[model samples]
Target chain A: MPGLEDLYREIILDHYRNPRNRGELESPPALRAEGFNPLCGDEVVIYLAMGGDVITDLKIAGQGCSISQSSASMMSAAVKGKTLAQARSTIRAFRAMMSLHGQALDGHGDGASGGGGTGAVGPEEDERTGAEVAAAEGVSLGDLEALQGVVKFPVRIKCATLSWHTLAQALDEAEKGAGPD
Target chain B: MALNDFGPPLDVARIKKDFPILDRVVHGKRLVYLDSASSAQKPLPVLDAMQRYYETTHANVHRGVYQIAQEATELYEGARAKVAAFIGAAAPAEVVFTKNATEAVNLVAYTWGRANLGTTDAMVTSEIEHHANFVPWLQLHQEKGTELRFLPLGEDGTLDLDQLDQLLDGAKLLAVTAASNVLGTLPPVRLLADAAHAAGALVLVDGAQYVPHLPTDVREMGADFVAFTGHKMLGPTGIGALWGRRELLESMPPFLTGGEMIRDVRLDGFTTNDVPWKFEAGTPPIAEAVGLGAAVDYLNGLGMSAVRAHEQALTAYAMRALKERYGDDISIHGPPPGSERAGIVSFAYKDVHAHDLSQVLDQAGVCVRAGHHCAKPLMRRLGVTATARASFSVYNDEADVDVLVDAIGQADALFG
Candidate 1:
């Protein structure tokens, strides 16, 4: 009950139903990145338009479960119109949340935070990338907090984080003057 | 499902008692495990076999002359014999052990595929394969330029065998799954084998899903290679077998070269060991093999026909119950009820993504796999990204089906 209530929040379902910034951006001028949750075959492709330090525009495209699609939808909204540094901070915070070793990062201090994430059994715990994402440069997870419920279901965390991780990889690639292939 | 209802008198409660994990509680309710297509729950006999082997006969096999070592060697080879007999193989020598069915496929991909197949020759497989059969061919096609062809799948999840001959033209091998893990569709293996033989091509059956549920006779199936895993058949993980024709195996080169697989190693070159051992390089899974033998014994005791009958009834029950309950809200894939199929039932509930559906199910202690079920190309073919799969085993009863139906209703209510 602790994790499920938050996991499938109404807002998250709404985002999944009608994702924001959904689609592909034209290439070259707009760099593209891709991510996949091999466990569920959830794929997320993000296109970034970087104008100076700010993200001018971004678009997300792929098929996946509610946590992933909604997370991508929420992620696209969170990063768009934000500076590259702020977006990068949010990625770090998200990864921290999904990290395996418990209490590694502050869990944004919600009421459910006291007894959050019962943790899925066996060999899969290591696969949970951001178990309890603690911090970011005050990027404020905001709508992304709906995904905090994914912590209890360790495997689904990968689904929730695919786009953000892909965005991080894209940003890193952008710095190297190479777009994600 | 109330134990007194109309169903098979298969002593499911006793069967469930065999698996220790069946008693586990998830989310404060009895765990109704429905992910047997992914992996089956090992029974106490299998567990005890491995435990006993580790405690008593723990030694490096094939190297030592000591008592415990001999016992260990006997156990490891004994598993091969048991597995061969279970699948109705000609000889134990035909069974080559690997890590899992995936590794078994890789073994063939590296050894047989690399040696015999090339650019000019083609390989035909189905889209319904669990990447084990699909990816290797794709890799062969890409890296070695082997012409790759797929057996077109029907909308009902059966193979479109009409294209078999055209696809098998000039093909050296036809790889296919005996049963689709996702859709629960049982392909006509013997028929496909005949088609492949007509085209002068060898057939490899990925029996990972089939061998566990069905009465598998490799010779009767008429396939050259039958690959399956121990874990999926109620044994421990890290043990799978590739039952190949002795002539083909002897002809093929070794996939993994090392200690046990070789007869003699010189500075210049090395001579390989016997057929199965030649393929099984290094130290094999000793205790795991013993466990596999016990699992085989367990299956033999149950009788494969009875096991198949029980699961078929359960599958048919699930189909009728789900349709009766959800109607058009749920769409079950695979051949309709009464058609030849196995235990797996993969379905989609309207717009509720499989992950979300499974999550709600999980809350009610119903365990099911929610994804492409490792057949992504098939998933694409079916026009869905993911599906919730409920697979049955020998232990599952009408009670389990009742729990699953209730859980689905809960998910539907939540999403609604």
Candidate 2:
């Protein structure tokens, strides 16, 4: 079985201790979305400032476990200054990396990420997923890949992914030009 | 029939043996289960009784003509009597077995609330109640436009009942928890029940936390209805009891309609069965009921007072240990170590998130519940998103607390 070292890596703890881009943004320009892990009552709020389909600035505001807080911190650092499409691809790659274990070990994906494309079904599917992950390697998960260990502990996967879900929701709202309620 | 004094104090080592899960080694360390508030580890007797029921007396209850069927029906009804006697209900018929205490409260909200409440009617609950007691009333209010009010929590971690009379003034029901699951604050339930009665309002005590820890008497509690689950009390899951006043249950309609909970039926409309049975529709959790009966027997053998005493002492030790070790760094969110609370000790250690604390503690084979504890409104009242709660049961002792304390110290070293 995987140990605590696997779950709480040094970089994750560093990110948790000194979170990046931690605060709220003005709602008029910054799209905000709140995500909640109903299982544990962990809440994450994502605020996005878009400059013409590019994420000009991103700030995360909320409280949760080490996984969640560090993830939000890492996510802000990763997605900031990236184009919308780049950010989306990064989110997908990060999610895919996090869910890689759930697919291989648990034969299921975390419900937040629909489980089909990257799931290794047979030899051919495994090769395709390998290629897909290699392509996502170009997207560069960077420090976000530190959360890949969260999958060993399935319950904490939601914790690590909560900020991502909120970020996705914020992007969705940005696309819709919807005001933060 | 009474909360009889079985004998001496619970021999911790002996008691630990009864719960086989205690023998488990998690992460190469001895299991130290402190999450009994979430669900207690079932004793061998409870497990064995369930298995024995399925092995020998597995048949449809109350519909048996054959010998095995009759035995099954007897066992099922006998379990009801055991639960009734355990809680000091007037009769077995007063105990309505449900899927869990949540369903029991829902049964009351659907049946009694539907029959008695209307738009103008108001129901008073407390901030510390589990969502089981709180949500059903809220649902009643939402569906029927009934007004819902809350008894606020005081600074001392207990309900501020100074405004109890005013809150229950025109209320039809006072739905509250006998104890706060998260804070472990044992509200003055008897006093609240009496006040509700004086105000001409029925009281529904959520005993999911209370019943497992204390010697309960529905008559003495003066509650119209008391809902408690089995899983938290060393019994199996999927079986809980709602002890209601017989007359009130008789007056209300059936909550769930189906096979077993009927005396007569027509194509147009069907007549519901007796008080408890009327609420318990379809095939009940027969084996689970048997397991609960065995659990009641186990607790009775341990003696509820003894069980309470053991938990009280252990909680005191845990509180003292935590405070002594962590000083101002640890904040235990409950009544200051005493009988005023159950064994639940919800705490936040030096800004460590509950999940993080629990995960670290898990490495030391210490299991604890880390969340809102299903009391979100209370979490908001406490001004925290979640807390790491370590609750004690009959089996838990000083050693378990020491293990918990040591593991928490490890967490402090790691996260400090």
Poorly placed runs, candidate 1 (over 4 Å): A1-3, A99-138, A173-181, B1-9
* lDDT, each prediction: 0.84, 0.86
| Reference-based TM-score, model 1 | 0.90
After superposition on all C-alphas, the RMSD of every candidate to the true structure, in Å, is 5.8, 3.9
Worst-scoring 10-residue span by lDDT in model 1 chain B: B1-10
Candidate 2, residue A172: lDDT: 75
**After superposing candidate 2, which stretches have Cα over 4 Å from the reference?**
A100-138, A178-181, B1-7
Evaluated against the true structure, the overall lDDT of model 2 is 0.86
Candidate 1, residue A56: Cα displacement in angstroms equals 2.8
Native-referenced TM-scores of chain A, all candidate models:
0.75, 0.79
lDDT string for model 2 (B1-416, tens) is: 13244357789999999989999999999999999999999999999999999998899998879999999999999999999999999999999999999998999999889999999898899998898888888888889999999999999998998888899998889999888899989988889988998999999999999999999999999999999999999999999989999999999988888988899988888898877888888899999999999999999998998888878878989999999988998999978878698898999999899999999899889999999888899998888999999999988888889888878867755577
